[model samples]
Target: MNLFINKCSKLHETQFNLETIHSLYLTREKIYGLNKYIENNIG
Candidate 1:
């Protein structure tokens, strides 16, 4: 029982980390695209 709980906790932590990284990557991509669009239109 204790071992199972420990394993579940570890898995949850890993999942949270992965989700956070994915969200950051997506945000960066969006920002990059928006910057490019602005530069193209302005210049």
Candidate 2:
């Protein structure tokens, strides 16, 4: 039972990490798009 619980926790941690990475990637893309828009307008 303990081993099963540990495995489940590990899986949860991996899922959390993946979600965090995805969010960071999305945030980076948004920042890049915003910068491009500003540059185009300014230039």
Candidate 3:
């Protein structure tokens, strides 16, 4: 039972990491897009 719980916790941690990474990727993309828009407007 303890081993099963440990495995479950590990799986949950991996899922959390994926979510964090995904959000960071999305934020970076948004920043890059905004920068491009600003450059276009200024130039």
Candidate 4:
């Protein structure tokens, strides 16, 4: 029972990390796309 709980917590931590990284990646892509749009439209 103890080992199962530990494993479950570890899996949750890993999933949280992936979500954090994915959001960061999405934010960066959004910024990059906005920059491109500004450059193309303004220039």
Candidate 5:
């Protein structure tokens, strides 16, 4: 987790801004959470 954040920090500085990366991360986390919820409740 820390290592991934560190790598993303580098990309945030060079390729994309922090805001963009953070928004994307949030969207991905939300989808992942939803998948887990469905799996636990239905699957």
Candidate 6:
């Protein structure tokens, strides 16, 4: 039982880390797009 619980906890931690990374990646892409749009419009 303890071993199962430990495995589940590890999985949850991994999922949380993945979600954080995914969100950061999305934010970076959004920022890059916005910068490109501004540059095109301004320049």
Supply the global lDDT for candidate 4.
0.99
Per-residue CA lDDT of candidate 5, range 1-43, in tens?
9999999889878766767888999999999999999999999
* lDDT per residue as tens, model 2, 1-43: 9999999999999999999999999999999999999999995
Per-model C-alpha RMSD: 0.7, 0.6, 0.7, 0.8, 11.0, 0.6
lDDT, residue 29, candidate 1: 100
User: All models: lDDT?
Assistant: 0.98, 0.98, 0.98, 0.99, 0.91, 0.99
Minimum summed lDDT over a 10-residue window in model 5 is located at 11-20
Off by over 4 Å in 4: none
Model 6: residues with Cα > 4 Å off, grouped in runs: none
Better of 4 and 5 by TM-score: 4
Clashing pairs in 5: none
Comparing 1 with 4 on TM-score, the higher-scoring candidate is 1
Q: Provide TM-scores for the models.
A: 0.92, 0.95, 0.95, 0.90, 0.59, 0.94
lDDT of 3 by residue, 23-43 (tens): 999999999999999999985
Greater lDDT among 3 and 5 belongs to: 3
Which residue pairs in candidate 4 have backbone atoms (N, alpha carbon, C) closer than 3 angstroms, thus clashing?
none
TM-score of candidate 5 to 2 decimals:
0.59
lDDT score at residue 28, model 6, on the 0-100 scale: 100
- Model 2 segments beyond 4 Å from truth? none
lDDT of 1 at 22: 100
* Candidate 1 lDDT tens digits, 1-43: 9999999999999999999999999999999999999999995
